[model samples]
Target chain A: MNRIAAFSIGAASGVVGTYLTLKEREDLKVEPKVFKYGRPDSPVSFHSYSAHSLAYDRARKIPLWVIERLSPHDIKKEITADRHRSNFQPDPFVSPHYSSANTDYFNSGWSRGHMAAAGNYKHDQKCMDDTFYLTNILPQDLDNNIDYWYRLENYCRQLVKKGYSLTVISGPLFLPEERDGKKIISHQVIGDNNVSVPTHLFKILLAEREDEEPPLLGSFIIPNKPVSDCPLRTFQVPLETIEKHSGSHFLQNLQRNKALDLCDKDGCKTISLNELTLYRYAQKLEQATSKEALEKLWAEMESKAIKLDKHITAIYKKKMNEF
Target chain B: MNRIAAFSIGAASGVVGTYLTLKEREDLKVEPKVFKYGRPDSPVSFHSYSAHSLAYDRARKIPLWVIERLSPHDIKKEITADRHRSNFQPDPFVSPHYSSANTDYFNSGWSRGHMAAAGNYKHDQKCMDDTFYLTNILPQDLDNNIDYWYRLENYCRQLVKKGYSLTVISGPLFLPEERDGKKIISHQVIGDNNVSVPTHLFKILLAEREDEEPPLLGSFIIPNKPVSDCPLRTFQVPLETIEKHSGSHFLQNLQRNKALDLCDKDGCKTISLNELTLYRYAQKLEQATSKEALEKLWAEMESKAIKLDKHITAIYKKKMNEF
Candidate 1:
């Protein structure tokens, strides 16, 4: 509280901040010059899969972020990998003490939503299957998981379909909002392990256009809850905001000023999901645990007000039962 | 909520847990045995100082932990360095985006408290000053900073005086407690940069006694707020608990059964602060900002009872003014 204030801090810091200027290894040497005491250990760890790489948060038992690159060739026409053949599983590489488990999401009134969407990795069966690992999932809201968020992922692929390849980064965010005059970041955690439920989710993309034009960089910070009313462009934010919130720098290889705004270049809009897709979504929603949530899901279903023919309902019911 | 329950999580996890069985760099290669994608980037960074090394959380702009090995020789007689001459400064190596500044704590109604204390590094002025880097600091409460927590640090040095060399790990914790039937971790952030103010602070100590016997490991997690009534031993919890909360492993090379309890070996008690010591603390208190806080601090002073008379008060006032 002894108010040292800003000017003093800025002045004092400019002198000592140079300690790390020598290298990215950032060895800091001060006067009287002494060697480092010991090696530093990473509080978080990174893992790789066929289509993606992710940094896991050891403390939260969740992935901090997932990075994936999608090329036109990687986005093939038919499903080369059937997601149905792949069941969700825990990652083998992470220690049990730190890794998230499939059960963390099972009946916790939340769905294990993929950060790197399984459908995006369909070029190879293994690529799609690996996306089911717990490290790539989060305790996501059912509505957000299978509906709007699903559409966003589709939107990413739509761009790929439009002849642009993309490097996508997705992650959870425990964002602070003004609550009762204080900026508070609060979220529920699931399972005995207390795996966190993020309040928001982010997707940052670098889409490389054909020809000599610079690639476009765009970012979205969407609420974890469903948002069906607004356009996808409403969620778009500056890249610096994402770095400030996620603590991870993205597109380090690209100069941001030279890059174009993704949403500006290619409009951010999601097509309405077909009826069969919504029925399939209802199947995933069946796994949600909370009694109130089940009731709420039914309420939402009733509000949809679109009923398919009896034959389709019968077929959907059979498919749902099989699932 | 689909309450999948604890049993389901435990059951599902045991089957797929072996992916990391091969190595610590747990490369989880699933069916199809495909090579990994690009390398995952670390969300956090690490840096080293002469007396300590720390893992810095890039997003939070704070050190996750600071570790120091304090031997008998390291605890020099009298003071080889005066802390009065060493002003707090920022570590140059940390990028401005991810590093905490002296400004973050300035006039933020919190103190810049050192994890590896300056007093503990009196072996040399450089070592002592290196500990002042903002990377090794937290936004600490004023009352706890100079009083109870100070005594606990003194206790660590006191153990070193007893022919024991100590390896100490210190950091801040954002612990959650049951609020309205839900576990919520909530803390106020300080400065325009929103530097996090931890709700609790921890000190994990591994003290090796002067013998062939194995070392003792003990940990304490104390509330960031002032606590004048309870004994320090009340804060002593099992090592496993600290691991769960902090997500950092300690005594990795030593088996638990061989190690003894640190608090049991040396009684967990703090020596009373003498009259002069209390007077100096009062001077430090003057920097505190809140009117209500100032009132409460004076109230705490009056409750201490015994007075130090006029000449001492005059000298203390002069010192306070100078500070």
Candidate 2:
């Protein structure tokens, strides 16, 4: 890029113009006409992180959207982050007043839920901890965060396990409801900082198709309240619906009809906690089989033989092989 | 800038990366670390215009904020754009469903208020017309839009007339209000598209200081409803208040105590409509004075002389010269 010596015509000396050093922007993206006199400095900032990237909505004290890329290998890694160690903390990068604090969610009957879903970033401890930052948080209903939202996250990982590169975009929504012949957008704001409690939360799952041209684009908008045993498919919505309300576009090349439906391609059903409990129980049962018990007995016998002497251990090994 | 052959790591092949063709982004602003597997694509889209620039909130269906630049010379231009000819229209750059339309405002009771007020872009017709696009609009209270909001805009122009170059950052605010025991953020949504009627509107005025280290930064948050003739200064707030609520920092160098207050520096009082009406009336009265009456009499005499004869007109001019 050649050095374009021209300056913006409009006198836009707002704080956002200096977000990056002028010298940094001196190279490009400086449209002479737009910033003819000054930069088109809007009151918004973009921040990128390891596990996820987000556009924080400073006004709402919530992220506009939290974006994350997930792969089966990353999700299925044996060594994952420990949730107990990571603490919910205010984002240091965000100004104190704009960044949400634990106090905001304290005694407010709400939970600070991760939009980037900490469980999804399990490949590394730091990557998982990154999702704990309030910048990636949303004021969510307690029961809903634990039950339905938790299950939905698993559903995302399940898709990855099925072998598609998944992009998860999640955020809060202040949906308008009809009242007195007029639609009203209303939600609770918690704490001294007044973090908004969104009326609804949306998650868009964009998965790359194996054979199709455009990726599978699926979006869902669910209420913040708990849904008792309701199918996840009930929340399914057109990707455009989320885009229009969120004021963002997903993929330009995406085609709805021809593109594989995420739900149809891979069932929208979530594995129940009861089933997971039983599966763990069955694994324990499987480990206690006669062959496993015999192996354990042989190991104990070998240890006893070692206690006796090296000659005894050699004799014990021969006996174990014969068995 | 070298051709960074690296693609993003966490797969973020969302639409935003393709916003300005992938080729354009091949050089810079594409941080390999952030988009290590894919792009760190957030749904938010930034659109720059001749009169203003804005970050459209895809979820909220409103601009996160509107930025504009103003100067005294531009405001005082002899020939300005005619507002009557400009029509309010949907922003073509925005998708149909996401973009606000005229039908969205039809019979909604709320008025489509311009964030970058049309009056401020009077220098060029096209610039003034650009403000009419819905991308620069917010659904606002009609009375407030016409009276108090209108005055605030004129106040901006008047500030320009005072010689300081001004930057106005304006947007809707759904501030939390204490109700019953908890704080609630509530606002009306109008029409089929559910366009949000912001509970409050804010204007942050950033004026260049002649000698001060940083610019004067002042902001105000006024309700969407009429103020019942209250002084505009009553709504004066610290710049941080707006930034904190909006979630975007204005200027990094701005120190509230050291930097001048825009309201204090310019005198927060707005020129009221009554005062404006009286001033216009006074101007009309000033035009019809005694000197003007004497000139009118001579002109009538000259016309009468012409009716009589050309020689008589010369005599009348000579006689009138003595008077």
Which candidate leads in lDDT? Answer: 1
Write candidate 2's Cα lDDT for B134-155 as tens digits: 8788888898998888888888
Worst 10 residues of 2 chain A by lDDT: A8-17
| lDDT string, candidate 2, A82-123, tens digits | 888889887655556556789888899999889998888667
Residue-pair clashes per prediction, in order, are 13, 29
Off by over 4 Å in 1: A1-19, A22-40, A273-323, B1-40, B272-303, B307-323
Poorest stretch of ten by lDDT in candidate 1 chain B: B1-10
lDDT of 1 at A190: 73
Write model 1 residue lDDT over A39-66, tens digit each, in one string.
Answer: 3245465666666777777677778888
Which window of ten consecutive residues has the lowest lDDT sum in model 2 chain B?
B9-18
